[model samples]
Target: MEPLFRLEGVVVAEADGRRRIDGLSATIESGERLAVLGPSGAGKSTLLFLLNRLLDPTAGSIFFRGRPLQAYDPRELRRSVVLVPQRATAVSGTVADNVCLGRRIHRLPCPREAVAEMLAAFGLDTGLIDRDARALSGGELARVALARAVLLAPEVLLLDEATASLDPPSAEGVLRALFAGLSARGEGERTVVWVTHDWALARRLASRMWWLERGRLSRPPEGADEAGAEGETRGTAAGEGGARR
Candidate 1:
């Protein structure tokens, strides 16, 4: 079977000649859970943007399901490849409206029951459904954004520091609900590419891992201590204040 996404010598560079992503080449298979790990400014977020057509590479090619990524309409491509950005965003409306945004975009039915179920799954009280979206906290907004994307049932889900705002226990609960919802969709129906500095969370969620550094893909240092590496990545994440290229 053809891979869901394939990149060949992909390069994303700024106008001033700094490369955000350089010579990245990889295949994302269907149903694979991929964890992308990197220090601050490692281009992890840039890679996700490219995959969903939010940003195109300055060089090389990207193919999705045997077709060049650019060949597909940007809106159409985005419907299949959804991205939950590092910063949570909410439309100006009620919580239910935000949760049903994807379906509305696709012109699908926005069933009230579905919205309630998704919110509940994300550990949100259904009573918040009618509440103003603008009043949500950072963590609440993150979960809402996640629920919005998941409700779309996109073929691929791209997450960039998605759970960063939540405490560990809350993050874990959200992840559990996320996987359960995805699993209910049936095996091989959805793929997840998660960008995270939390190594332990990545281990729990991903089937494979990729590391990026200085705008290029690379292996971890030889015999790197897992626990120490996790701490280092977490510390860097904090120092950088979640800023990424």
Candidate 2:
């Protein structure tokens, strides 16, 4: 499969010589659900930010579909590869309004069937559509964000600690919905790059793992029980997180 994204010796640093990402190189293929793992402040977010073009590398280059990232129009690049941040912001509007924000931004007509299907796919009631977004629970907010993002059908979805703010059951629900959505999308139809600290999450959702520590990326050590990876790319074993997520 062709690489959806390729990073070559990329470096992202602060003005004071603090490097958030250092000499990183990797290839993310189409349809690959990559779980980025690491301790706190390990540059996972920074890497995702770069992938989403929120920040450019200080050196080296990043390529999308073999073309330089900067070569693509920023608005166009972002549409195909979108980032859903950790803290989702719900505009002061109805759930339908929030969910359809993408189509609005793109100036497309509102497809009501599409909206309802997405809401159901994410385990949300269609009745919630008329409800206020800010009044939704944490779990509801997370699902709303996923519903919003997936509706766009991005080729690559960059999730930066997306479900981190939810409770265990809510997080699991979100993961399961995500996996189901990917499966329904068919292989190579969509790619997901999720930054998570949960080993169980990685074990369930990722066929390949990219562990980041100290601003560098590498595969996890051999014999580590990244369970269920060989069977399915769907996250299951929902356990409470122990380490800092």
Candidate 3:
């Protein structure tokens, strides 16, 4: 099968002359679950940024569905490729409103039956649908964000530490919902590229894995030293990338 995404020597450098993603080359096949693994400062999130066009590369090229990344209209490309960031951003509306927001914005059909089924699949009670979104807890808000994203049924879903903020059970629930949502189209019908520090979770869900360090890919399946270590594996608040609490 043809690859869904192809990167050839992709380079992303910041304004200060630092390379966030350096000379990365790889292929992401359609319907594959790829786990992007690395320590903090490894530019894992930058790769996602490049994929979604949130940050354009300083050099090299990225092709999506056999076309240059820059070839597609931003709005149209985004409609087919969705990214769910680590932080869940819920709009100030009821749960039902939040789930239907994407379809409404896209001018698509809003099927109530499908909406209710998705809510139940994510372990969300039907009663929550009429409740205020802003009043939800961290886990509840996470599910709400996921429901909105998955309902769009994007061809590719990019998750940047999406489950890192949730409690174990909640995180597990989110994972089940996500994969269930994907498999809802039949197994391996949609592609997923997830950036996560959870090695065990990666092992469980990702069919393949990539290890990045200092903006470059390393040999995988043995990327980091510890599997369950509590560490930050993405950009830091100070803009300088480092790993720790």
| Location of the lowest summed lDDT over 10 successive residues in candidate 1 | 236-245
Please list the residue runs of candidate 3 whose C-alpha ends up more than 4 Å from where it truly belongs after superposition. Answer: 186-188, 220-245
lDDT, each prediction:
0.83, 0.78, 0.77
Off by over 4 Å in 1: 186-188, 222-245
TM-score of predicted structure 3: 0.86
* Candidates ranked, most accurate by lDDT first: 1, 2, 3
Taking the candidates one at a time, how many backbone clashes does each contain? Answer: 0, 0, 0
**Each model's Cα RMSD:** 6.4, 5.6, 7.8
Q: Model 1: C-alpha RMSD to truth?
A: 6.4
Residue 226 lDDT in candidate 3: 54
- TM-score, each model? 0.89, 0.85, 0.86
Model 3: residue 163 alpha-carbon error in angstroms: 1.0
- After TM-score superposition, what is the CA distance of residue 205 in candidate 1 from its true location, in Å? 1.5
> Per-residue lDDT tens digits of candidate 3, residues 131-223?
898888777777877788798888888988887778766776677678778657433468788888876666656666788878988754443
Name the better of 1 and 2 by lDDT. 1
